[model samples]
Target: MTDDARARGLTRMQEVYGWKPPEIDGAFFATTVDHLFAEIWSRPGLSDRDRRLLLLGALTAQGRMETAEIQIHGALHNKEMSEEQLREIALFLCHYVGWPNGTRLDTAISTVTARVRDGGEPRMRRLK
Candidate 1:
């Protein structure tokens, strides 16, 4: 909405995702940066690490491996989680989220962990 919101959103994106998102134009993108990141993610009480864990669980439960991989990368890049912890999360979630979803989440974790360990840069999706 405002420049201030955009600035805060961009800053918060870096804080959360460990990288800068490309400035994109679209209602969805606007809402994501202006509202979701600026307002929701920047909220007090919940640390970024806590929020990330919750998001990871939700993403894994929904079988959203693509986004899960992104979050996994963020967690590792930000040093909020270790590869061991990520694997444990996938294992622990298997019973609750189902074996299939857990397997997908594990794959994502492995992919992101390998990339990060190899010193590869995070892959960014083109937001429309």
Candidate 2:
């Protein structure tokens, strides 16, 4: 990938996820930044808000709460979604995804929302 593409993706990734991988994983991280963020995410078919919502649903359904937390924070940070919108999404998914999955999603959303309300910085850490 071009330097410009990688740099742009890195900036966007940092804006959304709050952190980037270390140099130790530079190759993999570069690929992620170059292809996933720059190429795929830049596609015009979906708005950033729409992409975030899709990711939120998939992560929630898979019980990937940690990753989902970061996405939730991004949604709120970017004003792509409101607290009420998130709450409604959780409630609406309950019937389709089942109570257990929905409950976990709700808990994750509540935790992130509370942290944001308290003026705490978004939690950041290395991805596994």
* Off by more than 4 A, model 1: none
- lDDT tens digits, residue span 70-115, model 2: 8888888888888888988888888878888888888888999999
| lDDT, each prediction | 0.90, 0.80
Task: Please report how far candidate 2 places residue 19 from its true position, in Å.
Answer: 7.1
Worst 10 residues of 1 by lDDT: 119-128
What lDDT score goes with residue 3 in model 1?
A: 94
**What stretches of model 2 exceed 4 Å from their correct place?**
15-24
**Alpha-carbon RMSD to native, per candidate:** 0.9, 2.3
